[model samples]
Target: MNPSPPLAPGLPVLGNALRMMGDVQQFLVDTYRQMGPVYRVRALNQAFVIMAGERANRFLLERGDEVFSSEVSFGGLNSEFGMRVHVLRGRPHRHLRKVLATGLSRDLLAARWDDVTAATERELAQWRGQRALPVVDRCQRLAAAQLSVAFTGANSAARFATLRSAFELVLDVTIAGKWPAAALKLPAYRRARAEILAFARSCLAERAAHPTGGPADLLDRANEAKDENGNPYPLEVRAGMALQGYFAGINTVAYLYSFMMYALARHPDVRARVLAEVDAAYDGDRLDFERLRGLPALHGLVLETLRVYPPAPGSARTVLEDFDFEGFRIERGKRVLVATSVPHQLAEHFPEPELFDIDRDFAAGRRASVYAPFSVGSHTCLGAGMTEVLAVATVAMMVRRLTVTAPDRPLRITATPGPNPGRRFAVTVAGRPKI
Candidate 1:
C-alpha cells in the first residue's frame, strides 16, 4: 500500500472545526498553501482530505463519481429532504436525471423565455421608486417568480414566495450546521418545514386533479413517470424531487443575479460594454433568446462571476476503496473535499485570476474538465441551462431599464457556502423609456 500524505495538525476535540468556522474558505486556502495540493484535516470526528488546483479538481470530479459517491457529501441534504429512491444512485437515478434534463432542454428554455422576461419586467417595475434595495432579497424574489412560472405554472407566484421563504430558512439553518441543527428543533424551523411540505403536497394534489395537458411541470412529470418496470414513483419520491429542484434552482439563481448586478455596478466599463452589446442586439422589441445566447461577452461575464465566487465552494466525496495518487495512498472510507475556489484561482488555468475580464476568451473550446463552476461529469448541475437563461435575462433586463451606479462604499461579500454581498448594496438606477 502507498503511504498517505501528511495530515494537517488540529486541536483536540474540536479538531479543525474552530479554524474552519472562523473563515471557512480562507482556512481551506491556507491549509492548501501550507500542505501543497492535497492535505487532510480532522473536524467534528471526521477526517477529510482536500485536493486543490485544476488537475486535482479534474481527477476528483471525474474519478470520484465512479469510485467515491455523493452519498456522504449529500448526506445532510438527504436527511433533510428524505431518502427518495429516485434521487439515489442506480437505474432510478438515471431515469430521474433524464426526466429532469428534459425540462432544461434548449427548446424548453426557449419556450419559457416569455415567462422569464415578463417576471423580470414586472419585478423591475416594482423597484421604480426604490433606492438602496437589499439586492439579495429582491433577486431571490425575482428568481423565485421566474422559476415558479417556468417549473410549475404562472399561477404559482404566491406559492413560490412561500416556498422561497421556507428555503431561505432552511438554507440559513443548514449553513450554520451543528449550531442551527440543534436550534432548528425549535418551533420556527418545524413550522417552516411543515408549511413548506404541506404547500408542496397541496400543489402536487392540484396537479393530479388537473393536468396541464402539454408538458407537465417537473413535479407532475416525476409523479407520472414510470420506470422500465412500469411503476410510478411514490409520493415521497415526488416531493423529494420537487424540494430538490426548488432549493437547487432558487438559491443559486438568486445569488448569481445579485452578484452579476453587483459586479456591473462596481465596474462601469464592463457595464457599458454589456449595455452596448444588449442595445445593438435589440430589434426594437422583446429580447430574443437566440440573440441573448449569442452574446459571448455576457456569457463570459457570468462565467467570470462564478469563477470568482462559486456558489458551492467545495464538493465532498468518500473514497470507496484505497487509491494511489502521486505516490500517496488515499485510504478507503476517508472523505475528500475538493476545494473549488482554489482551482478557479490557479494561475495556470486563469492568469491574473483576481481581475474580472469578460473578454478573457478562456472558455472557448476549452476542455470541460478545467472548469468546476457547475462541476463536471454525471453529477454536474441539472439547472445549468436554466441558470444561463436566468443570468442573461437578468443582466439584459437590468441594463435595458437602469444604469447601475455603485454605492459610496464598495459592497462587502460574505463567502458562506454561497457567496452573497453583505446585507445591503446601494445602487442608483437611471431609467430609460420602456420598449
Candidate 2:
C-alpha cells in the first residue's frame, strides 16, 4: 500500500489551525500548491486529510460516491438543519433530488419564469428610495424573495424576514464546523431550528389549503412527487425537501448576484458589452428562455463571476473506503477536506486566474474537470439552472428598470458563511424609466 500523504508544516499541537483561522479557501489553495495533490493538516486536536488540485479533483468528482460519504461528513448540518438532499446517500439522495427537481429543474425555470420575475420586481420595488445600500443584504432579500415564492407561494418580506435570519443562524453553527457539538443545543440554535421547521410546516399547510391557484411552487410539486414504490412522500419528508430547496439556494444566489452586479460595476468594459447584449435580447419587455440562453456576453459574465467568486466552493466529505490518490492513502471514515475550487484559481485552468475578465473562454475548463461553481458529481447543486436564469434575468431586468452603480473601487470580500461582498459594498440603485 502507498504511504499516507505527507504532512503540512504546522506549529506544535495546533498544527495548521492558526493558518486556517484567516481565509480558509486561500489556505486550502496555498497548501495544495505547496504540498502537492494530497496532504494532511491538523486543526487544534483533529487532523484532516485534504485532496485537491486538478487531477485529484477529477478523481474525487468521478468516483466520489464510491469513496466519499457526504451524509457522514455533513452530520453536523444534518442534525442541526434536519435531513435534506445534501445529507442523504445513494437511492434516498436520488429520490429526494427528484422531489426537489419538481421545482428547481430547468424546464420549470422557464415555465415558472413569471414567478422569478415577479419576485425580482417586488424586491426591486422595495429598493426605490435606497442608496449606498449594502448590496449583499439586498441581494439576500432578492434571493429570499425568489426562493420563498418558488418554494412556497409566500412572497412577503415580513414573513421571510424571520426565516432568513433563522436560516443564517443555522449556517453559522454548521457551515465550517467552527463550534463544538454542544453549540447545537444552545437556546439560540434551538430557537433558530424551531423557527425554520415552523416556517416549512406553515408553508406546507398554506399550500395544502389553497393548492389550486398560482404558479406551481416547490411544495406543490414535492407534494405531488411519488416515491420509488409509487407512494407520496410523508409530510415530514415534503417539509424537509421544501426547506432544503428554499434555504439551500438563498445565500449562494445572493452572493452570486451581488458579485455579478459588483463585477459589472467594477469593470466598465465588460458592463458595456453585457448591457448591449441584454438590450438586444429583449423582445419588447419580455425575455424568453430561448433568448435568455443565447446571450453570450451576459452568460460569460455570470460564468466568470462564479469562477472568481464561487459562493459554496469546497465541500467536506467523510472517506467511506480506503483509497490511494496520487500515491497517498486515504483511510476510511476519516473526514476529508476536498478543495474543489482549487482548479478555478489555478493558472492552468483559468489563465490569469485572479483577474475577473468575462472575455476569457470557459470552453476548455468545461471540457476538462476544472470548473465546479455549483459543486461536482451526484451532489451538484439542484438549483444551478435556476441560478443561471436568476442571474441572467435579474441582471437584465435591473439593467433595464433600475439605475444600479457601485463605487469604482475594489470590492471588499469576506468568507464567513461563504464569499460575500462586505456590508459596505453598497450600490446606488433607483428606478429607471423604460422606453
Candidate 3:
C-alpha cells in the first residue's frame, strides 16, 4: 500500500499556526520545499492537507462540486458573512449566482461608470497635498465611500465611516480565528456588525416600499431577485446577502486598488507606460467603460498586480469523498488548500517570477494554469468581471491626473489575513506635471 502523504512537522500544540500567522505565503512555500507537493499541517487543532504548484491549484479549484465543497471548506465564513451567495454550495450556489449575475453583469457596471469614475476622482483630489498617507488605509476609506453609495445608497460622509468600520472589523474577526476572534468580542466590532445589519435592514425596507424605481444599487438588484422556484428570498436573507456583498465589494476592491497603486509607485517604467496609455485613451473630458478598456497599460498593471499579490493568496475546499492525489490516498473531511501565490510564483510558469513585468502576454492560454487571482470553476468570484472593469477604471482615473511616489524605504507586501501593503507603505500623490 502506498504510504500516506507527508505531514509537516511543527511545534507541539501550536503546530504550524504560528508560522502561518507570521508569513502565510512564505510558510507554505517552505513547507512545500521541505515536504513535496502534498503535505499536512495542523493548525489550531485542525489538520489541512496542502497542495502546491499549478497542477495542484488546478485540481483543487476545478474539481467537480460533488467531490469538493466550498461551503465546508470556508465554514468559518457563514458565521460572519451568513449563508449569502458567496458561501452557498451546490444548487443553491448556482441559483444564487445566476440571480446575482444580473447585478454583477458588465452592463450594470457600464451603466454605473459615471458614478464610480466621479467617486474615484473625488478621492484622488483628496489625496493631493497630502504629505504621506498609508495607501491601504486611504484606499479602504475611498473604496468604502465609493461602494457604500454605489451598493447601499448610503452617500452620507458619516455612513462611509460606519460602513468602512463594519467591513474592516469583520475582516479582522475573520483573521483572528474563530475562537480568539469570538473571545475578544470587541464591543466596537459588535457595534459595527449591528450597524451593518441595521443599515441592511433599512435598505430592504426602502426597497420594499418603492418596489419600482430607485438607484441601481446592490439592494435594488437583490430585491428584484427570484430563486429557481420563482420564490422571493426572505427580507432578512436579502439584507444579509446585500450586506455580504457590501463587505466583499468594499474590502476586496480596497486591497486590489491599493496593490495596483503600490505597483505603479514601485515600478517607474511601468508607471510611465500606464500614464502614457491613460493619456492616449482619454481625449474626452468624460470617462466611460470604453475609454477605460482602451487603457492597456493600466489593464496590464492590474493583472500583474493580481498575479504578484492576489488579495487572497489561497483557497480551500473540504473533501467530501475519498480521492487519489498524486499516488497519495486522501481521506474525506480533510481540508485541501490550494496555494494560489505559489503557482503564480512558479518558475515553470512565470519566468523571472520575482520581477514585476507589466507587459507579459496575458491573452495567451498561459494564464489558465498559472494565474487565478479569482479562483475558478463553479465557485469562482461572482464579481470577477465587474471587478476587472472597476479596477481598470479606478486606476486609470488616478494615473491620468496624479503621480504617486513610494516612500524611500522599499514598500513591503504582507498579509493582514489578505495581501496588503504593510504599515510602512505610504505613498505621496501629487498632480502630474502638465506636458
Candidate 4:
C-alpha cells in the first residue's frame, strides 16, 4: 500500500486556512512547486488532497467523472441556484450540457455581439475621463450587464447591484468557501437568493410571452428545452437553468475581463499589437467570432493573461472512493483540489512563466495535461469556447475605444476566495485615444 500524501505545515485547527485565504491561485501554484504534485491541506475540520502538474491532471481530469463527483463537493452551491450543470455528474450532466449548447454556441454569441458591445460601451461611457475607476467593479458590472442581455435578454442595469451582491455572496459561501455553510442562513444571503430567483422567474415569464420572432437568447432555448426523455423540464428546473450563465460566470468573467484590461494597460507594446489587430479586424460595426481567429496578438494576449491570473483557485471535486495515484492515496469523501492552472505557470511547461510574452508559440505545448486554464476533461467549462471568443472580442473593443491607465503602479491581486484585481488596480480612463 502506498503512503498517504504528505501534509503541508500548518498550525493547530486552522491548518493552512490562513495562507489559503489570500491569493489562492499563487499559494496553490507555489505549494505545487514546493510540495510536489500531491499533498494534503487541512482547514479546521475540512481536509483536501492538493493535486497538480501533468500526471496528476491526467489522472484527475481524464478519469474525473469515474473517480470524483462534483455534486458531492458543490451540491450546496448548485442547490442555491437550483441548477444541475454545476453539480450533476456523468450522463445527466452531458444531456443538460447538450440541451444548453444552443444558447452557448458560437453562433449565439455572434448573434449577441451587438448586445455585448452595447453593454460594454454603456459601462465605459461612465468611465470616460473618470479618475481612478475601479477595474474589478466596472468589469463586474459590465460583464453582468452583458450576461443579462446576451443570456436572458434582460436589461439588468438597474438591478446590477442586487445581482452582484447576490451572486458574490453565494460564491463566497459556495465555490469560494470563504464563508461558512451557515452563511447562507443570514438575512442578506437569503434576500440575495430570493432576488436571484425572482429575477430568474421574470426572465422565464418574459421568454414565454414572446417565444419566437426575436434574436434567440439563452432563455428562449431553455424555455423550449426537453430533458433526456424528450419531455419539457419542470418549470422549476427551467427557471433555475435560465440563470445558469449568471450562476456559473459573472465573477469569473469579471476577473478575467479585468485582468485582460489590466494587461493591455500595463504592456504598451502588447496593447499596440492588440489594438492594431482589432482596428483592422472590424468589418464596419460587426466583429464576430470568426473575425477574431486571424488576430494572433489579441488571442495570445487573452491566453497569456488567463495563464498569469487564473480567476478561480482551481476545479473543486470530492473523491468518491479511496484511490491512489503518484504513489499516494486519497481517501473516500476527501475533498480534492485539482490545481489545473498549476501547469499554466510551471517553469517546466511555460519557461519563464512569470514573464508576459503573448507571441510565444503556444500550440507546441498546449495539450490539456500541461495547460488547462479552463480545466480539462469531462467537466471542462461548458462556456469555454464562447468565453474565449468573448475575451478576444471584448478586449478588442476596449483597446479600440478606450484608454485605461495607472501611472507608476503595478498590477495587484486580492483573493476574497479567488484572485481579482486589487483596490490599487484603479485606473483612469480617457475616451478613444488615437490608434
All candidates' TM-scores?
0.87, 0.90, 0.90, 0.94
Q: On a 0 to 1 TM-score scale, where does candidate 1 land against the true structure?
A: 0.87
Q: Which is superior by lDDT, 2 or 4?
A: 4
Instruction: Give lDDT tens digits, candidate 1, residues 46-130.
Output: 6788777666767765685566777655655555554343225656667778776665555655677787688779988776656
Q: What is the lDDT of candidate 2?
A: 0.76
- The clash count for each model shown is 0, 0, 0, 0
Best by lDDT: 4
Candidate 3 least-lDDT 10 residues:
175-184
Q: Against the unseen true structure, what C-alpha lDDT does each candidate score?
A: 0.69, 0.76, 0.71, 0.78
lDDT, candidate 3, equals 0.71
Best-matching candidate per TM-score:
4
lDDT of 3 by residue, 13-114 (tens): 888877776557778767877887888888776678888777776676567476776765454455654546655677878898777666556665566666
Which residue pairs come into collision in candidate 2?
Answer: none
- Candidate 2 residue-wise lDDT, 1-435, digit = tens: 899989999999878866565456678789888999899998776778888877866876789888888875555556655545777778877887877777776665666677778878878887775777788888888988877665665664675666666566556555555555576677875786787778777877877887857557687876676766688877666677677766776788998999988888778898889888988888887877678888888888989998887766677788888988888888988888778888888888888988887878777776676887777778877888788777887888777777778888876566656678777788888787565
User: Candidate 3, 244: how far from true, in Å?
Assistant: 3.2
Error of 3 at 256 (Å): 1.6
What ordering of candidates by TM-score runs from best to worst? Answer: 4, 2, 3, 1
- lDDT score of residue 325 within candidate 4: 81
Clashing pairs in 1: none
